[model samples]
Target: MDSSNWAEHLKQDFSKIRLRMLEKLEEFSILRLNPKHFYSIKVEQESSLSPLAELASINLESARMLHIKPYVVSQKSLHEIEKAIKKAKPNVTINSKDNELICSIPEPTAEIREEKIKSSKQVVEEARIALRTKRQDLLKKFKNWYPSENELHSNKNSLEKEISRYLSEIESEWTNKEKEFRQLK
Candidate 1:
């Protein structure tokens, strides 16, 4: 692959790490609610339809409430949105009022924050492992590109620096999210 392709692959790998964290979409944090988790929800009795992100606009109404206003504003769409949310997160309580669905997230207690912080650390560590694995795979590919042993070693070192840079980006994001969870609302 060319240098441009190499850069794109590295960028995509970083994004994959972020998307993996969104696998825990059932959690109350709106930041973790990536489109990947809600992209498949069929709405309005349609076999093929837009995803939840397109069907509605989500607003952080409050620390404990997320307001979702559908663009079409139909009863069937409302029910479908409600069903999608319920299917995605059964524990969250959703109320419909004035053509909007309000998802009631539980108050973030200290225990919950602590639990989330722990889990966030675990997820970051998993990302680190995944990154290392990706680096290994990339190294094998690089070996073919760099025939000389010394040249391959130099490229491997540069690759390690790039991997560390991506890991630091993930680390910074996790720390910020942890701080957000620890905030007093």
Candidate 2:
């Protein structure tokens, strides 16, 4: 109702937007395979899902190689881990030897690279839609909170500016990821 309360409300809304943006970025990150990406993979367990990292120890053997050894050594557990990796469909060759699984991440082909870029663009667009929805919700809240037309107009301008800044930041993040994906070998 007051100026201070409105400012605080705006701050909370901005923080929520930033948090959602970060979550979207994290989701995008998992779509690509890096040394750390393996950790994001989840395996089905009875009635729950568990992260691959929790079930297995993934060691980076080289820049393009990973050695995964499950802590609970069993035929079924190993098979489940292997199945999870295959389901992820990462550009990697999986070989089971002894009790460990060796993952060989090869350089992306031209077609593969193109596909990844396209997928990244789709993800960026989805993030933009989410951000736009959040902006609209904020505008609705502003309308309900601010009764004066002049004050509402001023707040709308500032909110639009903030939204533009966040959208640019999201674009920059996607660009950096695209560059990284392109440079992979």
Best by TM-score: 2
Global lDDT of each candidate: 0.73, 0.75
TM-score result, candidate 2: 0.66
Encode model 2's per-residue lDDT on 1-185: one tens digit a residue: 44446545645665665566555544443234455678978898766889999999999776567889999988888888889888885557899999999888666577867876786677678777877887787788877878999989998898788778878887888788777767755
Per-candidate count of clashing residue pairs (backbone under 3 Å): 0, 0
> Residue 174 lDDT in model 2?
78
Q: Considering every candidate listed, which one attains the maximal lDDT? A: 2
| Backbone clash total, candidate 1 | 0
- The TM-scores of all predictions, comma-separated, are 0.66, 0.66
- Model 2, runs deviating above 4 Å: 1-55, 72-91, 96-99
